[model samples]
Target: MLPKSILEHTLVLDIETVSAAASYAELSPTMQKLWALKAEALQRRLAEEEKMTAADYYPEKAGIYAEFGKIVCITVGVFTKNEEGQYKLRLKSFYGDDEKVLLQDFSAMLSKYFQRRGQQYVCGHNIKEFDMPYICRRMIVQGLPLPAPLQIYGKKPWELHHFLDSMTLWKFGDYKAYTSLKLLCGLFGIPTPKDDIDGSQVGRSYWEDGDLDRIEVYCKKDVFATAQVLLRFMLEDPLALIFESADG
Candidate 1:
């Protein structure tokens, strides 16, 4: 296979989200009512033994839904040619308790990338379904203006080539099942640096432990893993494309 460099003009991104409230007890009356409604739909999908009230499931489930959660961290990486003529992924992050501010900053960076590169891609695993849409919805919820890349209101599918998904590539057009990036990395034998935490524990780490730094590290590793998977899809050696953090 040809080593088509999707990374050249692509921005790799991953986000960490936590429940809007620390606990179900903390939700406002309106939100509590709303979550109960949402939770009924969630509960119906579970087996009998797994059934529970919406409040009981709130801690574990809320963060996954954009309506019930807020992004605490968004890490982005881009493949760059370093000083020694080696390729490195430069990473930048926008994160914190303040969702509006983080989203605004990320939007500004996205706008700049579009202006600078004129329609470069945004790559991630499951971004087409999760990351991209969640970001767009959250921006709308916060009343932020949608950047051009995100402004997909009436655009045809053919016009939206700037979004790439490693998981989608792995599907080979067979959309039968979902594949995890960690699993893909294992199959490709690409080393990952994700020992500390995982996606399931992100909400706890954020809400209970109050650790944004740890979450940021996890998100960054996800970005790297995503980039490496794309390289493997293109049949390129991931090691040769040196991984570097330009977060300074």
Candidate 2:
């Protein structure tokens, strides 16, 4: 089992996103033109799929870009002491159609919690490259003030002790290896977050099925799995059930 110390006050986060519009046809004429150019620039990565066109790429790849996508859910988990003085995780999700409202609420919670607890760790799987930067970009797009922990502009590398990435930690300085959260969970024997749906299905769920609730649940599961993966990194039992207590 994991030591209580490692989990305490550490934040785990995950986000679910979808294209800002339901379909390529729904995008503004200007945005469609922009995406066409962007797709052409990225076409080299699809060397084996030369048949795929820009319209074909939008549904699959656009959500990974904050400029083209919208975050439908952002789930954050933290270990807190229960009434019995035992450490257990608590998960909260901010989600809705109005991205600005959810972002504001999430930042407010971050500010209030960190103000009370002092500076601390903010962690997730592949968080350094994807989650944090995407959030910052979206916040700027919305003209929202960044939370203190996210004001990373021009800070020295060592100054970001509060930031952590489970994937980066596992790489052991192997910069080329890109490990997915699901792969780490399986390697560590933690429950898979893909039981319900995968990231590829998230956009379809939101735009076609209108299943935001399912997306929120999937996001929480990933956050929980991330915590489990981190515990394994601390040389603890990856199956630790402490996170089972996390209330969403």
- Candidate 1: misplaced stretches above 4 Å? 1-5, 83-85, 116-119
lDDT of 2: 0.83
TM-score of each: 0.94, 0.91
Per-residue alpha-carbon lDDT of candidate 2 for residues 1-248, written as tens digits (9 for 90 to 100): 22447567688899888888887888999999998888888886666747467788899889999999988899998876677664456888999999999999989988987653234688898888899889999999999999988898997767776777888888887989799988998888888999989999999999889889999999989998888788777786656446542333
Q: Model-by-model lDDT, in order?
A: 0.84, 0.83
Candidate 1: residue 83 lDDT (0-100): 77
| Deviation from native of the Cα of residue 156 in model 2, angstroms | 3.5
TM-score of 2: 0.91
Local accuracy of candidate 1 as per-residue lDDT tens digits, 1-248: 42465557888999888889998999999999999999998788779998987878899899999999989999999888777876688888898899999999999988877653334788899998899889999999999999878888776756666778887778878989999887888888877656789888998898889889999989988888888787777777776766677676
Question: What is the model-wide C-alpha lDDT for candidate 1?
Answer: 0.84
Q: Note each model's CA RMSD in angstroms.
A: 1.8, 2.5
